[model samples]
Target: MNFTTQRIEDIVVFTLNETKLDANNSGLVKAEFTLLMKLESVKKLIIDLTDVESCDSTGLSALLVANRLVHANDGDVCLVTSSEKVLSLIRITQLNKVLSVFDTLTDALQELKSK
Candidate 1:
């Protein structure tokens, strides 16, 4: 559940500071991330997952909720991660098609900023 929040222009970036993203903290992630999206100034989200080396189904579910929340608000959400394991899970679950994945925070920030 430990993370950092920062605003760069209209994008609200949430940097997950945990290594394992699982059921134990997914609910918290869902809650905090949704709260951030409710801010009127937040038009997009970049979830920096550089510290998150692993993820589970519940974690992906939390991510899905974040995605839906952003879209519901007419905003966008992108996942920024260099972890192959996390990317593999997203691919295996076919979430890579649904979620925007970036290899680095810089890439995600740049792309989301342009949108």
Candidate 2:
């Protein structure tokens, strides 16, 4: 998994630098989320999936894992993506109701900041 992380105050921004988030790499992403949630003690998280053009069920599972982890600690997680396919999948799965979705990193950060 190619990624980078940034911290703004208490929020951690995880930028996944991959064109496809599928079964091939979703496990690593899930592991990283667990590590970030447990070891780093991250409460608020922003998953920047701008580079991810495609996603599979495994990818969505990884996101749910992140959401579960953060919310378990009384925190929140948001996803930022400009891919229409990704957005459609979220809507089709009704994950839009469960996860916060944003069109840009700035938008996600602003919302998370307010919370």
Candidate 1 local distance difference test against the native: 0.88
Enumerate clash totals for all models, in the order shown.
0, 0
Scored by TM-score, the top model is: 2
| lDDT tens readout by residue for model 2, 15-109 | 99999899999999999999987788878999999999999999999999999999889999999999999999999999999989999999999
Model 1 RMSD vs true structure: 1.1
What residue runs in model 1 are displaced by over 4 Å at the alpha carbon? Answer: none
Q: Clashing residue pairs, candidate 1?
A: none
lDDT of each: 0.88, 0.94
